[model samples]
Target: MPFVKTTWRNSISFKVLLAYVAGVGLSILLIALGAFALITSRSDILLTTDVAERTHELAGKLLFDAAGRPTGFDDSEGDRVWTFKSLGEEIGYRVLDSQANVALASTDQAFWSPVAKAAPSEQGHFKFEREGIPMYAATAPVEHNGATWYLQFAVSERLMELLHQGFAWPFMGAGIVLFSLVLLFVFGACAYFTLGYALKPLREVSESAATISPRSLHSRLESKNVPWEVAPLVRSFNSALERLEQGYRVQQEFLATAAHELKTPLALIRAQIELMAPDKGRDSLLDDVAHMTRQVQQLLLLAETSEAHNYSFAVVDVGEVAQQAAAYLQRMADAACVGIVVAGPADTQTPWQADRSALFTLLKNLLENAIQHAPAGTQVRVEFTTSRLTVRDWGPGVGQAQLPQIFTRFWRGAHRRDHGAGLGLTICQEIARAHGWTLVAQREEPGLSFCLSRHHAGPG
Candidate 1:
């Protein structure tokens, strides 16, 4: 299937397994061929060498008289006599003098005489036929009592057939096949386990990378125990993180600097507007200046909250913080003709560890956002516990599609009543992130609810 092929192409483990299997198969095939060739070449050589050795051995066993004329063999109780008896008619030999005359021959002399005559003069192997049966022969020189003689030994072709077709070929083939299978299995298992062990560090690197964000860009992958082949990639990735961290820090610094620079001029403009005579244009100018000043201050707070190191952490009560935020936004709720209610666990003792100032800012922003959206005479409820906080307003909640964009920087929903900059929810989300928490928006049947909960283990 196409899926299988794609996996084979893309997966490292599949590729490695395939390569290992192929390499092992090729090696096994080559070894089997080489071994077969060696056996084939050695079989012929062994036959000839065996014939020559038997010729010499028979010559040594020949018995002679005092005049040095050849007689019958000693026929002693030894290996040569036993070999002659065991082979019976399959083996034949002849001993000839310096004049090339036969001195002694096996009982079957008629068949062996032609073979001896056809043998080479010097020591070597030759072939002949006896009654249409093919045979192999070898001639060798012999010395006895300072007289030189030649011995020719012949064996039937059936002997070679027995060695090749009868036993060696079949056993060698089965052994090669069995050995190749066992080797493939054992080596394949070893390769699979080794590849898994080697790739463990990569999995660890992935987990570490998942934890990295603008806030925790300082983290890097650990290199210890990693394979040498992958070490360079890990180093390169760490170097990339270093560069990214530097760029993010520079951007945060620019945002903070720009917001700080705008604050002083806005203050001076406000002081100047206050000096002007009471008029409709003067009030409009002051309102515009105040909105700009609020936007600048929110930008500064966003920059600070985005960095993990900016917040000082300590134990703080969630319920108390909720009450404080409600009280702080009471005037704004009153101006909008909306009631503010705080409800949570009765315990006042601090139970959560967080940056007190950042937590206050986060609560304040959520409550302020709720107050701005709630309908007249409707209540904006603030609820909290040791682990969570929620702010709900009885007003026209945003559509489902707009829920995800509520915490995005400078993003305002369709439900709005003022010309204020949309950085409040974004600042709240950043503060929650710095404290290893999650802030989310859900649509209550008749309102929108914002929940900030201690959910994650660490900053992004």
Candidate 2:
């Protein structure tokens, strides 16, 4: 339930759904309140109208009796009779002569109480509580047989209270509940469908964008049939893609040109140095040329693998690749006094479609980095599976702070090793990314482990 509440608070669709439901409920409540007010006002008007009519009738009865005319009573025969017996049981009344003395009453006992002890209201109406019973009361003056009389009447509010509590209040309460539930259900459903419909174009844009690679930069977002609010963003994104494609093309041309221009002079220099007399200085010059040549080769490899350059995919055995990389780099590891060990399924021939050259580069760089950092006589272990490979070495592991930046281009840590441009792990990351694989580095207890996995994709 907490998770659901959190989701409702966080999610846009749920927020919209709740907002609509709340708005509908508020509107229904306002309408119900207005209806209740109107009904109560009309009930008050009917009660007051009844009071005025009874006051007029009482005055006429008194005037007729005083004029010695028939009042539907035989007062001369000593039997006092009452009129207006048809009044409700909840109703009570009193009559006062000119002196404010009680001359007649509808009930056997007095129910109407004066508003004040010294001076009572001559004509008006008000609500009051009498003996814990709520009543609506009124007082009015009338002329009868050349004198004045005052009539005070009251109606018990108990029946009206019961009527509202038993029926009206419950009906209103049920109405509000029913309205809230139906509003939530019906509006929530409609909003869900409406939001899906509204967001359909954005989903399409995402799917189309996912398919666009560095190779397919010519692809642009389709603005037609999309929402007006998102159309400008699509156009801007397509424009940015065009600029990036131009930059990529220029970079690829420069790398190709640079490699061709530098390789010829570098080869000639190395060839000329080999013909000189063998000496320490001469050997050092040759070593420098060899290093420069290796750097140039790595630069070209980095350029090719970094972008959407075509890669060859074929059925290659994982164990065989690990064995080959270990064998090729064995001499260097030996010179560094670091041992190499390949461990995996014995004689396993699980062939997978992959760019063999790219995989070799990835493996070679990892091995080279591991061997360079491992302590003397410490073994570097390379493990292989059908879908994963891990290379681990027993050297001081990378700093926790520097782990995230290890794969960044041209990034080097404060450690001791051979001097070379820091493109090894960067190239490895690019190759992995190009093949839709994940290459992650983790700090081992004594060293570091680089794992390459999810190697399951066809030629792109």
Candidate 3:
């Protein structure tokens, strides 16, 4: 039922096509009805004519002596003299005297009897329904030797019904089929272009909306070119974009000011903590300050990467960048009793065009994440190829359910022990996205691997 409802709501072409077919079908139905009425009406006339003609022939065959009356049946005469073409099933006819008494009946069934209905005038006819069977009859008065007698002829309802059905259905079937094809072609073509013309502005609006990213929020939708019905919607959307751009500008300013205001006080606190005693409590205070400082630095880096126009691309080697990031994080790895191993093609320069600072930060965040999570004495392996850099650590791998959330801001795993804020993977993801690359996280057998690679667009 949901599938049916969705198709019905979304399919304008099918609705239009069905409407066309229905209109044509109704016209054909009306035409068929009129034709049936005409044929049925004409069959009555034909029945009356046939019975009247048969009565006239029967009148000629009437024989009488000095007294005028119907002659007795002759055994030598064949059935032709009595048989009727107008009578179908249960065929029969009656010969009646002037007093309306049945003198002779052609079949074994009881003969038709006159009722209170008006009798047929000379050469005229009347219809009667007896026992639910329509009987058509015509009367012709015959005079023999100065006395009078009458001949009556009749047929049943089944005859006329058969004739009508035979003539009506074939033509109706043919007419419906031909009109269906014609409507499908003519109306289908018209509806296709008509819908396209009507939806043209909506398609343009969609294309324009797709291009308006965070950097392009200043762009507004053009309402003058759209239909009047959709102009209000476009205006409302442009107004919303205006609000968003304003909020984005304010938020960026606040982040920049906060970074400046918070960093100085944090640096003073770290300095003050270092001048204190070498006890566990003092060490804990210093660690807390360092953790806070790292969070602020990551927040600042995230803010910078949000603005894409600030980037400057340079040609750099993936292997060289990986080696430098490992060296920079070596002391941190050693402090945790973990090893750092950088592996790639020997003497192979896998060159790529990227913002060198962004790539370095991307590598730094991933390396830090791998080293922090790695078990003691287990190496964090950094591998580089022409297109991608992968960092694998031999620690408890992320759960399958949590892999998708790893790159989200401030999302930390249950197995993690660091007091570090969870912006590391988020920063790496932002950098990768800024450079049109893809960052992926995979859960290994006994560890997790984070990889960054060049993203390729699909074929047009």
Candidates sorted by TM-score, best first = 1, 3, 2
lDDT of 3 by residue, 154-178 (tens): 6666765565467545676677677
| Residues 54-97, model 1: lDDT tens digits | 66666677777898877757757254655555775667777778
Q: What is the TM-score of each candidate against the true structure?
A: 0.80, 0.63, 0.64
- Writing each residue's lDDT as its tens digit, candidate 2 over 1-460 gives 1433455577666778778878887888787787677456647665566556654554445533655332332344223233235544566667666566766677654355524432224456666666777777676776655666666667667755555667877797788778777777887788889998987998899799888876677788888878999999988999998999899889987986797689999999999999999999999998899888877887888888866656877778877887889999999998988999999887668565679988888899999989888999899999877778899998998899999999887786555378666789988988887878889999999999999886446351
Give lDDT per model, in order.
0.81, 0.76, 0.76
Colliding pairs, model 3: none
Number of backbone clashes in candidate 3:
0
Clashes, model 2: 0
Worst 10-residue lDDT window for candidate 1 reads 114-123
Mark the regions of model 2 whose C-alpha exceeds 4 Å error after superposition: 1-15, 43-181, 203-225, 271-284, 413-417, 455-460
Instruction: List the RMSD of every prediction in angstroms.
Output: 5.7, 11.6, 12.2
- Candidate 1 TM-score to native: 0.80
